[model samples]
Target: MKLVTYRHNGKTSIGKVEADRIIDLPRNDPALPDTMLALLQGGQDTMARARAVRGDYSVPLSEVQLLAPLPNPSKFLAIGMNYRKHVEEAARVGVQTPPTQVWFNKQVSCINGPFGDVHLPAVSDKLDYEVELCAVIGQRCRRVSREDAASVVAGYMVCNDVSVRDWQLATQTMTVGKSFDTCGPTGPWIVTPDELGDPHALRLRMWVNGELRQDDETGSMIHDIYAQIEHLSTAFTLEPGDLLATGTPSGVGVAMSPATYLRAGDVMRAEIDGIGAIENRVVAEPV
Candidate 1:
């Protein structure tokens, strides 16, 4: 079942994706709840209800807006250099790959809708784009075992971890470079865990101005998603609606021989197999 959180007519609601259009779940259903977070918090019972819901709502998908699947995540964790090609490219740029996962916080304030626009911040001319597969946690987990990590997943979504290279390099930690407002763009649709078999085998790709930049399969990931989850859960409790932006593959603009970067008016699209694509345009930040 593909689940989605959408807004129409100034009201936001949870719905199921069918035939590329979201079918509104009845608010009075005994099993399903109203909000995506509530449905996730309800666990399997809510999912079961979401699966069974049928028929239509008042709004057609064309009239509605798709928000971040989980707008306010308990934790917005991102993995860095988890892809082998990305590692090699970083090395080519004189960046070192850490022995362990380079996890960083992408503040929830940076979250934007699937079709939203991302700003080419005036503060930094080194803006870049990262196409990634993000996992949405469905259950509360602590010290989670790698063997059982898949069970805690709610779904997957396409994400663009937009970065400002200058701010990111200024700090030892990458949060400042990563957490600019509107930096994290995700959605189009969330493919439920049941339908998106083997998260590590899917293909993720990204394009800038209609040119393919990053094109690689998740099978190329060095540490892999399960290991990333197991490693992260060991340090902190993973809760429902928590998001994990599993690192991007190689072919980023900054890694180019001439080091290209995003400019205002450039449109970026990131896509993952089974999970739909998300697109955003680069625009100048308001003065």
Candidate 2:
């Protein structure tokens, strides 16, 4: 089932997507949780209930303003240089591939709706895009093994890991550069693991102003999702509603010879097979 959070009648609600219609869960069953995070924390029982719900009260997809599947994730983390090609591209610019999986925090404040506008920050001129597949945690767990990682994942979504190249390279943490407001664009909706099948085999592509920029498959990840979970859980508990960006492919603006960075009015479309796409436009930071 594809789950979404959308605004209708000026109020936000969680719903399920069917074709071009959004079946509002709360309207169908008053007992259901109204928010995505709350519903996720309810676990399997909640999901079962969601599955049993019928499309009694639904609105056209065009009528509601779709928000990020989970508007407020508890922790928004990302893996870096997990793709061999991307790592190789980094090496050309003097960045070495890390011996172990490298993870960074993308401040939750940076989260934006799948179709929201991305701002060309007035503070930085070197903005870049990284198309990645995002895994959404279903249950809270720590010290999970690679074999058990699949059980903890609820769904997947497409994400654009927007970066400010200058600040990222300037900092040791890479948090500041990755966490700029409106930088993290994710959604369309979450496709449950069962529906999505193999998370490792999806195709990921990114286009800027109608020009193809990045193209690769999820199978190319060096660490893969299960290994990443095993690695990250050893350090901290993975909570429901937490997000993990699986890392991007080889082609990115900074990797280009002349560095073709984003400018105002550029439309960036990031798509992952199975899980829909998000199209965001670049605009000058608002005053």
Candidate 3:
């Protein structure tokens, strides 16, 4: 199932994607939750209900505004230097690969829609983009083994881990730079685990303006998603609707000989083969 959160006619609701339209789930069954987070928390039966719903009210893809599929997830985390090539690229920018999984928190407030605008903060001009496959947690679990990890993942979405290179390098956590408003752009829709067979074998790419700048495959992750889940869950509970940005591949702007940072008016298109694409335009930060 491809699930989406959208706003139509000034009212926000969750829906299931079918072809180019969104099946209005809440409208079909009044018992259904109106938000993606609530539906996930409703557990398996709610998902089953979402799958079974045949709604007469569906909005054409172009007619409604698609929002971030899971906007208010409890945790919005990402792994850094998890791709060997990206590891190599990081070294060029004076950042090294961690001997262990390096995780960072992208505040939930940073979440933006699939086709939203990314802010070019007045504090920095070193903006960059990283295309990653983001996993949405389906159930609450702890100490999940790598083999059991797939069961806990609800689905996946394409994300642009938009960064402010200067601020990112300024602090070790990479949180402040990563947590800027509108930096985490994800969705188009979430593709359920069953619908997306292998999470690690998809092609991920990002383009700035009209030029392809980053290209790689999910199979290239050094730590991998399962290891990430197992490692993180070991320390705390993994809840439904939480997001895990698996990692991004190389060819980022900061790695270029003459670093190419994004500016206002730049359009970034981030895509994953099985999930979909998200296009965000860079705009000056609103004061």
Best by TM-score: 2
Instruction: Give the TM-score ranking, best first.
Output: 2, 3, 1
Q: Tens digits of per-residue lDDT for model 1 on 1-287?
A: 77778888798888887775778875636456778888889888778877877664545678789988878887888999899988999999999989998899999999988999998897888999999999999999999888998999999999899999889888988898999999999897778887998898898899998999999999998888889989998888999999999999999988999999999999999989888799999999888
Candidate 1 segments exceeding 4 Å error: 26-31, 56-58
Give per-residue lDDT, candidate 3, residue 78: 96
Candidate 2 local lDDT, 1-287, one digit each (tens):
99999999999999998888999998999889999999999999999999989999999999999899997888999999988899999899889879988999999999999999999999999999999999999999999999999999999999999999999989879999999999999998999999999999999999998899899999999999999999999999999999999999999999999888999999999999999899999999998
Compute each candidate's TM-score over C-alphas.
Answer: 0.96, 0.99, 0.98
Count of residue pairs whose backbone atoms collide, per candidate: 0, 0, 0
Write down the lDDT that model 2 would get.
0.95
Off by over 4 Å in 3: none
Overall lDDT per candidate, in order of appearance: 0.88, 0.95, 0.92
> Which prediction has the highest lDDT against the true structure?
2
